[model samples]
Target: MNASKFGAEYALSDDMAEFPAGHTGAFEVPYPRSCCCSSGDADLLEAARTMREALQEVWLVMDALGAYQSDDDRLSILHSPKFSSAAYRVRTAMIKTQRVAI
Candidate 1:
């Protein structure tokens, strides 16, 4: 499943459809337009990308936990390569989003 599916409700909300062409629908947060040098679409895209990465980490962590067969297995899954990779993706995306020409 796509990571963004986790936030489908918010991402596909009616509020999104209400945004004007250039208005950064950064949702109700009122994140200043000056926060990014890029256009509204760019800001929204970057935010969506970051959200996807973060959700990926969440899913991976949950899956890892569910796959654990025993107490020892829990630690192994938590430190598993897949979980680590997903977490790294989230970390990088978060950093990228923060530095998105703000």
Candidate 2:
């Protein structure tokens, strides 16, 4: 399911929207505008990329959890290997339908 299905309940609410056109060198889906680059160090830039990707990872996990909660089984995720793995992990963790011996 698309992330927008969650509406305005996102964690990074302000930074959630796409960067304004011309704000970055290019208006791309994965734009370079997400980073501040205070030191301009190569390692710092790499860290920013990793952090952004991690945020995306958690977003997909939340999305999958929402879909499963709504009982929408048709929401299929074909891309994003890490997201696919993380989604099921989050889905199973959040769901309380598992059997218990109590």
Report the lDDT tens digits of candidate 2 across residue range 36-78: 6544455455554555665667776667657445444333343
Candidate number achieving the greatest lDDT relative to the actual structure = 1
- What are the lDDT figures for the candidates, one per model? 0.70, 0.51
Query: How does candidate 2 fare on TM-score?
Result: 0.30
Question: Between which residue pairs do clashes occur in model 1?
Answer: none
CA lDDT of 96 in candidate 2? 27
Model 1 global lDDT (CA atoms, 0 to 1): 0.70
Superposed on all Cα atoms, model 2 deviates from the true structure by an RMSD in Å of 23.3
Flag clash pairs in model 2.
none
TM-score, every prediction: 0.48, 0.30
